[model samples]
Target: GVDQLETYFGAYLPQFFYAMLAPLTLFVYVCTINVTSAVILLICVPLIPVSIAAVQTWAKKLLSKYWDQYTALGDTFLENLQGLTTLKIYQADEYKNSQMNEESEKFRKITMKVLTMQLNSISIMDFVAYGGAALGLIVSVLQFRSGHIDMAGCLLIILLSADFFIPMRQLGSFFHIAMNGMAASDKIFHFLDMKESEKGNQEFPDNHNISFRNVQFAYEAQRPILKNINVECPMGSFTAIVGESGCGKSTFAGILTKKNENFGGSITIGGVRLSDISEKSLMENVTYISHQSYMFKGTIRDNLRMSDPDAADDKMWEVLRSVKLDGYIKEQGGLDMKLNEQASNLSGGQRQRLALARALMRDNSVYIFDEATSNIDVESEDDIMAEVHNLARTKTVILISHRLANVVKADNIYVFSDGYVAECGKHEALLEKNGIYASLWNTQCEMENI
Candidate 1:
């Protein structure tokens, strides 16, 4: 969008001035030779803009649709390209290829329509400009024949009649370029006009206890994800939220990180409203680590430093050692080893350990481990959980996971079912009740034994 606007302004401004000033100058010259010829030229110049305006009315809708399709096609292509390996694994490459081809065809049709509109508009402007010039020359010849103007004056009018319409005709050509920029600007303006989420200026309180009271959330109005969720993670407590898939375990934790703010009820941190806390203070106080934590394309030291930019080499190694990743880093060329995109070169366990190491480097008051141990080997998972337990001794740790075993040591376990908290207690207490939590735990135990 920026590129289109730049191209339009950079090239259109000079042409716009020429179109406005040059045609008036020529009109004055023509009037000196013959008033009637000057009047005819003046009248015809406006017809070019009339045709351009007519084209613009339709081109606006066409170009807007063209940009929409262009953006959609680009998004689809990038998504498919990034997931190409997964597609090939599932033998779905041909399907995705055909889907992309359909998107490309739609883009091609819109582009051709834009071109056709440009061509038709230009043709109309050409007819108005040249036909008007021809009309002026005809009048000049008539005045010459009637002896109202001399032969020199008539010949000059004939030569310069076309010049009168040339500037306006060129402007008609630039109108199409400007139209594209205008369409892009409309989208940008619409985005800028959207209402921002309200935030308060209060700083995070020193006491880090977190609580949710009757909190409810939904991505859509009808389908609620978290309903009447009331949980608490007091300072220096190991609070775990365990649930089956789609049971809102992650959604419960997501509220603390401000992933989604549109919810019912209220959440408070140290008796201060969650919404009252400023974004900077909230971010500085919380660290969220998920199973698929993003790793940038940089050295191991570089990725770790994102959590603590000024962290020294000794501190980095200490954090890495805590996650049992120090030996792996030392063998793989130390902290300076370059990681590929998403750190694809590292195994799943190694990546999670590295992510854990990075999180440990930050001195946050609250830590959220959202399925952080999933898909990793037993050894790496144990090492990561050990660090998490250690962190819980000081920081307020909220663990969200579907795995029943990992939450066995939690100070309090909140088991979510559907969108509500169905059970809440310690691991043994919930199991003794023989409720949803016990059912899930027993099923998992049976699966592992099998």
Candidate 2:
């Protein structure tokens, strides 16, 4: 597409300029030689510019529709390519191919319409230019017969009349290129005008005390994910937000990370409203890590450097050791080890620990682990939970998990149920009530015993 654009512009730009100037320039000289024929030619001049404007106005809409269809069809094709393996696994490849064909057909129809409009516009310009030239020739012959102009003058009138309309003929061929360029420019300007995320200049302090008062949120109306959820997470504390899947515990973590900004109620960190703190300052003091953390295709050193580029080798090893991954990494060629795409070479536990090490490199005042230990062996979970406990001694730590055992020693725990806080207390206190939290725990306990 980029190469097409470049070629289109290169071919049409000079022709477009010459089309505008050549006819007008020749018309003046034609008038000097034969006024009658030049007047006939001039009569057609206003009509071409006006018709060009009208055709261009109409082509603007068609061009936009054509581009939209082209993009959609490309996206469908790309999706089919990326999901080909999944389609084959499920024996649904033919169905996906049929879907792609339908999109391609739709794009083809729009493309035909665009070409029709371009040719139709060019046809109108061709008719006017030729009609004017014919009229000029007829007028020049009449003047010649009456002896109002000499033979040389008459001959010049006929030749110059063809020249007069030649520029318009060239411009007719450039119609598609000019319109496409304008359309592309309009789209870029629209992107430039898009609004950025709203933030403030207020800086966050060293304090990491966090609180959410009557916080409310929902991905969609009537299907609320969080409802007036009030909670507190003090600095230097280990706070656990635990619940069954789909009970809004992850949504609660999302709110703290400011992903769902339109939620109701105020959330503050260090006494400053989340919206009030500058993005740079807030990120420096707070960060989020999840079990599904992405490890890009690069060396281990490259991935760790993304968190803190200037971090020394010793610091990287220290964090790796803290997560109990240093010994394995050291055995596997140390930090220079190459990671496959999505870190497929490592086990799930190794990937999560590497993600943890990357997160720790930032030294943020508050860390939110949104289900950071959802899967993996018990040893890895124990190692990560222990590290989280140690980090909570200074930096604020908030854990979101469904594994009841992991949060038993948390300083405080908030059990959520159907978008609301069902219980808030230490693990033992919540267990004593034998309510929703106790029920979930007891079910898991019995399953473990089995």
Candidate 3:
């Protein structure tokens, strides 16, 4: 898109004026010398655009297909590259390679079709331009022989005949590029014209209590993910949402953050409707951290500053100490120490701890930890949860975890099954009920014992 836009603005637009005016100026000059030849050249100049118009009907479809195949090839390559290790581990690399090769071949075939169409159009334009010039030259010779014009006039006509067609020929060339630019512009305009999500004018309410009443959500009409779900995560409480995978646990958190806004019921923050709160105000009061929280390739200080841009060095150290990462950072050359992409230079536990520390820098009223402690060492998980529990002392903390052990201390644990809340209460109460939560807890306990 950038390349096409640059070519359209930088080269095509300027050349467009020259192509239109240069031919007219030269045609008038030829007319002054030989009217017959000038008229013939003018007649032939239109054939160039006529041929372009003809090619355009076919070129538009071809270019669109070319772009589609190009995008598909790129996506396939990236997906394969990201999953290369897994493919090799499973001995499926050969199958993936074959799939990628098929996609590449399709792209190559479409690319050749685009080039062949361009060549054929250029050939037609060349034939019209030179044929018209040749015809004009013959007319000039015939006029000279009849003594209707002088030899000098005939030579001038011959010399300038090609000039008449040159501008139009250059235009024919630019027409193909213009077609490509227009194709890209079509996609860009479609995206730009799409309706944006509605914005609310209401400010964030002072009360941070959250309540979901009869919420229902589905990606498709036939497949519901959350059905008439009602839950509460009041301020100054620790609320945990736990369920088996595919039971809409994450979708519950997603609704509060406005990730999925097309729900049937009302979600309110304090007393204000969630949709009524402006996005800026909602974000200012809520912090969501997940297991795969992204870590940029920068210094430790640089990453922390994302949460609180003006946080001082002392404050950074304080948060790091809260996550028990301060000693590790100091040992690794302090906050200025550089991290590799995705913080791959650090161990998995270190990365999570650092992420938690960065999140701690923010003074948001609500903190949502969506499986934030997953895939980490027990020590790191315990340390992170300790800080999370501490935060629950005065803030609304919602924890979503797959591990049944993690939410045992939560003041309120909502157990989801299928879509609705199957069970919700303190850990001991949930276990005593012998329902979904109890079943999940017993299963995990049995696995741990094994």
> How far in Å is the alpha carbon of 276 misplaced in model 2?
1.6
Ranking by lDDT: 3, 1, 2
Instruction: Please report the TM-score between candidate 3 and the true structure.
Output: 0.96
For every candidate in turn, the CA RMSD to the true structure comes to 1.6, 2.8, 1.6
Where does model 1 exceed 4 Å of error?
none
TM-score of each: 0.96, 0.89, 0.96
What is candidate 2's lDDT per residue for 1-450, written digit by digit as tens? 333466457766677678778777877888787777777787776677778889988888988888778878889889889998999999999998889889989988988998888778888888888888888888999999999888999888888877877776766676677678677767776998988778868988677589999999989998988989999999889999998889898888787776777889989888988988887887787889998999999899999999999999999999999999999998989999999999999998889899999999999888999999878888888888889888988888898988888888899999998889989999989999989889989999999999
Each model's total of backbone clashes: 0, 0, 0
Better of 1 and 2 by TM-score: 1
Cα lDDT over the full model 2: 0.85
List, residue by residue over 88-160, the lDDT tens digit for candidate 1.
Answer: 9999999999999999999999999999988888888899888988998899999999998999999999888
The deviation in Å at residue 46 for candidate 3 is: 1.0
Each model's C-alpha lDDT?
A: 0.90, 0.85, 0.90
lDDT assessment of candidate 1: 0.90
State the weakest 10-residue window (summed lDDT) of model 2: 1-10
